[model samples]
Target: MLLAVGKAAGPEKTLTERYVERAAKAGRAMGLTGFDVRELPDGDGPTRADREAASILAKRGRGVLVALDERGKALTSEEFAAFLQGFADDARDVTFAIGGADGHPPSLRQAADHVLSLSTLTLPHQLARVMLAEQIYRAVTLCIGHPYHRV
Candidate 1:
């Protein structure tokens, strides 16, 4: 599960849909199930983030929450694949949260099991979704010993 703030618009939305489709196909090919995304309501700043974080956490039933934040730890593709393999081995659900422009609130970051950063630079929300989906697909391929991830 992926919890994101704001809705994708125009071409970003189209690209996001395509990336999602590709990610799902990749996951299926790797025999990994449950690749989904959930868009949350948009609100003002930290307060909105707090509310959305609460909602996202509430829906997580014994699942690990991974919050996306600039301040979070960075991992290589191989590292990420190993991280995901841990969850898969344990049969645990993992939720990746993407906050709005104001970024994730302290409450949300504190609540996350793991805080990960896609990059050091700031990214538009829509583009982040596409990059994340592709990374997920890449990770799945890596886990299955697929040549898609060439070193």
Candidate 2:
């Protein structure tokens, strides 16, 4: 699952949806069910981050929670594939979270099973989703021995 604070407006939404659909289709061969996204309203004010954090946390299920933040451990594509494979091996769900404009609160960041840095630079939440969705598609391809992620 991919959960973000706000909906992607134009091209970002199209790209995200495209990648998610690709991942889901590829994932079926790997015994994966879905690659879905949930969009929440942008939290406002000084408490926005915390409020969004609460909302994201509330939606967290038995899956692994991965928070996307700048201050996170960066992983290579292969390493990320292994990380995901470990969860899939255990038949677990994984939720990749993207926060509001203010980014994730410390609570959500700390509570995440793994904190991932998409890039060293900060990104708009929508673009982050697009990036994440593409990575997910790539990862699924890698997992099933597809050539989509050729080096």
lDDT of 1 by residue, 1-151 (tens): 7788888789877776776776677777656686887888777744886777777777766789999888999999999999988988888888898887778889989989999999999887778887787788778888888888885
CA lDDT of each candidate?
0.82, 0.91
The number of clashing residue pairs in each candidate reads: 0, 0
Candidate 2 lDDT, 3-122, residue by residue in tens: 899877899999999999999999898888888999988898889999999999999888899999999999888888888888888999999999989999889999999999999999
Lowest summed lDDT across 10 adjacent residues in model 1 is found at 23-32
Residue 139 local lDDT, model 1: 88
- Which stretches of candidate 1 lie above 4 Å from their native place? none
User: What residue runs in model 2 are displaced by over 4 Å at the alpha carbon?
Assistant: none
In model 2, pairs of residues that clash are none
CA lDDT, candidate 2, residue 66: 96
What TM-score against the true fold does each predicted structure earn? 0.90, 0.98
Tell me, by TM-score, which candidate is best: 2
